[model samples]
Target: MTTLPDHYEIVRERNGYGSADGAVGPVPAAERRRFVAVDDEGVFDRADRRRTLVATGVGMTGPPHLGTVGQFLTAVALQEAGLDVQFVLADLEPYHGGAPLDRVRRLAERYRTFALDLGFDPDRGRLRTQEGAREVMHTAQLLAPYYDPDRWTEDAGDDSGDTDPPPTEWERAVREAYEAGEDDRRSGTAAVARPGPSSEAADIHSAVLHGADFLHPLYAGDYERLVLQFGVDEHHLVGMARRFRDAAAVEGGVAGLYTRMIPGFDGTPKMAKSIPGAGVSLATSADEIRERIAGDPGGDPARSPVFQAMCLASRYDAERLGRLERACEAGDETWDRARSEYAEFVVGLAERWRATEE
Candidate 1:
């Protein structure tokens, strides 16, 4: 599991990003707003708001979980803060996991509606797909050669079978999906067998598309500077794009804004759609969400799953969040009232989302 301390160290020191204290730029207005770190902070700090585009995306492997909801909210917040934004529905990604094309298309439409309902203004920005996006796909091919095969093939053990480091959350999720058995991707399925040498190469190639998801906007959308938002676990993709842009001699500068990874209830490093019952989602029942939040607030207020959900999933302002945090620490009645309100907020949002499908 990737601890917060170690993750912070990698972003701040190893990646040469500005520290959280130094997060000076156009950012979302949430409580405890920290960029964690931003690559090329100066370029981001000075980028023109009108000409800059902030991009974020989610995979269509599953429905809208709280983690995914948080990402959507971040995009809305960025747009409301005055910078143009683009939200990509990565329908093509689940296809790589063997999801049927028709099912992927349905999920992509659902995701688009959800983002609009969550306050992402189509007038100010764009909500696009990774599949059938002609220019973006072309950009991926153009950038493919620069993806650096060494990024993955290196440190891979020789035939002697020396083990590499532990698998990341993504790798673990993929492995578990394949281990369970074949099924449709609505339940988050994977390839039938474990990834072999050739399959591993395919995985690396998919990353080039991931790079294009971020870079294509700068080239095609006519944006001068681009800011990418993702969870801290996805920080490596920033370096991947930087290398590709430099190698390919692509114009335009890029920077990143990252959110903290919310730990899963299943004791996994982070909440994920592939992990059943890992955390609350739009599909979870209202009674269950209320019970879950009230039953266990977790040990630390800052690290508490309940509080984290409230911070990310709910539309609570910074002042209210601060007040609830203080009350939670004191174990007062205010916290109790606030907890019930938070549960209702999530429940109502879930109900509205479910209604869209019906």
Candidate 2:
């Protein structure tokens, strides 16, 4: 069995929250959230013994994108801090609704290779696909019923009619299959739900709300099961997990995943995937990275996607980062060079950081 670090207690206490009761009032949000903190000041004193950490998210299909890069950088920092980190590729999620099976598989392979090339240790960590995980489908099924629009009504005075309508008998059957632990049924249900994009924000909202409500409760049960199987204490992790699970349930879907929505390059409320020049992908070639920075609609590379990518990448030198910002503002001759320099710098820094542990 893996022994947890002494610092796990402190980190857990700092990040803990209470579990949710599905029918009751909503769960309260906690002040401090769980995260692996690492900087020049060094890793948290208690983090020395943390052997494994997991970073799981949906794979990129539109373009290999910078969001994936951000996640990998996060994993890299954890590994540099001496903790084992696993990158779980949630390919099943995209396969369910966003991307075709072949596209999803292709992206997963590319992402795995990118991660390996960038420094993730193949021995200590892996890029796993959720397609093989029966639990994900099972969980997806159990949560499907809560997504019924009839289960919730929109708040009075709210103009956005984003809440899902009542579930059809078909939807209920899908949920039943999931609840009964029918993996094949759950997968089939997910496969059927996978096509087409919703026309409005409200439609998207409704779908997310249902998914969150269903998944949160199901996750809580899974958490308890894991605690028992691993013989780990449920005190610290349970509360936060429950809070997120409940909030996701209440809000209805993955939309609640972002407690605070980040602004896009143009200072818009929503980031546009259609604007390729406005975003950066993890698989973005060096030339593409530079071109995007130069074409930023904001004209200020400091607040551009390039800068945002650097911040998320967390590999650029702090002093250099500031200089890059100032150079952009001043319209200095080195501004163009700064973009290339920063990208190369981050790539090298990530490589070095990943290599130290091995």
Candidate 3:
């Protein structure tokens, strides 16, 4: 909510943005393009001359939750719109994110299965696992020399305007990772669980590496068009595409599609695994999903996780969604009834995902 981008107006209506904000208008007929670091380019329309790739990824540090599924659903919408979509399993960063080795390994393996369950098209889009494809690490290594520690601090603070946060111990470790040749990485022994100051520090290095990992491969391979879909807050990583000197638009300059962060089920800031009762697991029972949704104290219509669920789930059923919206506007018992419908919508999605897995 800090600021809206130009593309936000166009893509927001595709129903993938998943905000409770009333629809401004249906997506207008326009030339297919995306927001680059400092420019917008007509890239998607020129697929005949060169291949187009739309990619989004998540760190495998936790189970796929409602938030995770929401991101995947948005990716699916992009694919449906004829964007070449790819799902990246960012399994590498958790290793440096201060997560335990066993936990990181487990989550990395588990995330792929759940991602498959979430209905990512295996035929159309490939799961670019960082573990399997060392391109993530290899790319990071190639781009590491470009960033000195000072600019590193600046690039890391892109999300926070004006105020640059203090450095944490994890940042020192990330710096060491940069200095230490690829063969000499001592990250495994030094890594610790991300919490408090450690999480903040771990994030800076993770962002640098993740960005390079994403773009370098495409750049090296000479991809004609690359669309990067990531968490809205992580746009700085996408901006790394511009860091390369003298690279023309034809060398696959990256465009960004940042997915909106889904709020927690209990209306806490963001849906996170570390926060208790804040996340609804993809495999949670319908009863459990209802219970979690009901736990939200409905003070603000906008903040209500139920309403957010409706925003996302409505993609599957527009008629029911319209009815729920009308009920909420009317107020009283009808509004209360809409809650159950929202719950039903979420449960139905979970059910479909489960059924498909079975």
Best by TM-score: 1
Judged by lDDT against the true structure, how good is candidate 1?
A: 0.68
What is the number of residue pairs that collide in model 3? 1
Which residue window of length 10 is worst by lDDT in model 2?
Answer: 223-232
lDDT value, residue 54 of candidate 1: 81
**Local accuracy of candidate 1 as per-residue lDDT tens digits, 110-176:** 8888888889899999898888677888998888877776652434422122454455444465356
Worst 10 residues of 1 by lDDT: 189-198
TM-score of each: 0.82, 0.50, 0.67
Could you tally the backbone clashes for each prediction?
A: 0, 16, 1
**Candidates 2 and 3 compared by lDDT, better number:** 3
Predicted candidate 2 versus true structure: per-residue lDDT over 1-358, tens digit per residue:
1112222333223333121112111111111111222111121222323421333343444544454555565455545545444466656545555467788777677666667666677566445666654554555455545443332322211112234334334234324443433343355532222233334443444344333322432454321111100001212222223333564453211111111111234332212233322345434455655555565433454235555555555455546666766766666567667666666654554344334334
State which candidate has the highest lDDT: 1
**Candidate 2 local accuracy as lDDT?**
0.40
lDDT of each: 0.68, 0.40, 0.54
Worst 10 residues of 3 by lDDT: 24-33
Residue 88 of model 2: what lDDT?
61
What pairs collide in candidate 3?
A: 98-192
